[model samples]
Target: MDAWATFWGWLFVLVLIVFAILSVAITIGGFFDVK
Candidate 1:
């Protein structure tokens, strides 16, 4: 049970990191006028 909990915690943190990176990338792209 402990191992499973740790695995899920790590997975959640990884997903959060990925989401943050994606959001930052989108925001930066929005700043530039690319047509």
Candidate 2:
């Protein structure tokens, strides 16, 4: 049970990081007019 909880916690953090990166990338792309 402890291990499962830890796994979920890490997964959630990883997803958050990925989402942040994607949003930043999109913002920069729009600013630069990259196609």
TM-score list, all predictions: 0.78, 0.75
Candidate 1, residues 1-35, lDDT tens digits: the string is: 99999999999999999999999998889778463
lDDT of each: 0.93, 0.96
The pairs that clash in candidate 2 are none
Q: Pick the candidate with the highest TM-score.
A: 1
Worst 10 residues of 2 by lDDT: 26-35
Model 1, residue 31: distance off in Å is 3.5
Each prediction's total of clashing residue pairs, residues at least 3 apart in sequence or on different chains, is 0, 0
Tell me the TM-score of model 1: 0.78
